[model samples]
Target: MVTSLYIMLLGHLINRAFYYLKQKWESRALPSPESHPASQGVLPMYPG
Candidate 1:
């Protein structure tokens, strides 16, 4: 039981870390909203 709890805690921490990294990466990689066609009303839906 203790081992299972420890594994669960580790998995939770790893998931959280990956999620945080993805958020950071996406924020850096994606273009600004001003350049997005949808945001500018150029297109009713996302291009892709």
Candidate 2:
């Protein structure tokens, strides 16, 4: 169905976006946490 295709596309897009975002994030020189913080689940926003 067309709805299924749309859902699949949205899922793929979200996966790719997260992948790229993580790549861009690690490329930064941001310091690692002093110990993993509770906020660690919140990735930094891409400033581009």
Candidate 3:
């Protein structure tokens, strides 16, 4: 019924939001100096 449809829509929106946020965080985290092979030997990576 209407309630089922609403719940489905809400679940879809929440899943999409979580997926987007995880991708955004991983993109920002995966490229730091500590993870980068070239920078690992040269300098310490500091979190800002």
Candidate 4:
């Protein structure tokens, strides 16, 4: 069915996006001091 095909396409897109982001992050060495402000924008990894 077309609906099932659409769902499968969407799932593939999401998986690809996550994989790309992971690869991009891995290639990066580190952020500069100027970008420290961005850290504030991120929620703690483990929000205990």
Candidate 5:
């Protein structure tokens, strides 16, 4: 019974960690203003 409980807790922790890592990866992979060509190329006439 104790072993089964430990296994269940471990499984939950692993699943939570997987989701947290996936979210972190997705946030880093997304493109932002810095990734735009115009932003990286020439300065804008006026700051928007």
Candidate 6:
């Protein structure tokens, strides 16, 4: 029982770590919002 619990905890930690890394990788891969053409003037707040 204790071993199972430990395995569950380890799996949870690994899942979280992978999720964090995926977010970081995606952010780096995608273009920044400021550089997007729509962000320039299409949006009210941005006001290109």
TM-score of every prediction relative to native: 0.63, 0.55, 0.61, 0.52, 0.59, 0.62
lDDT of 6 by residue, 1-48 (tens): 999999999999999998787666645654464577554334433323
Alpha-carbon lDDT, every model: 0.66, 0.68, 0.66, 0.60, 0.63, 0.65
Residue pairs in collision within model 5: none
| Candidate 6: residue 44 Cα off by (Å) | 31
lDDT of 3: 0.66
Off by over 4 Å in 6: 32-48
Q: Report clash pairs, candidate 1.
A: none
Clashing pairs in 3: none
Tens digits of lDDT, candidate 4, 1-48: 999999999999999998787556534533443555465325323122
Model 5 spans > 4 angstroms off: 32-48
Error of 3 at 11 (Å): 0.4
Q: If both were scored by lDDT, which would come out higher, candidate 3 or candidate 4? A: 3
lDDT of 5 at 10: 100
Q: What is the TM-score (0 to 1) of candidate 6?
A: 0.62
2: Cα error in model 5, Å: 0.6
Model 6 has a clash total of 1
Compare candidates 2 and 3 on TM-score and give the better one: 3
lDDT of 2 by residue, 1-48 (tens): 999999999999999999887766755734665354654547555232
Q: What TM-score does structure 3 among the candidates reach?
A: 0.61
TM-score comparison, 5 vs 6, better candidate: 6
lDDT-best of 4 and 6: 6
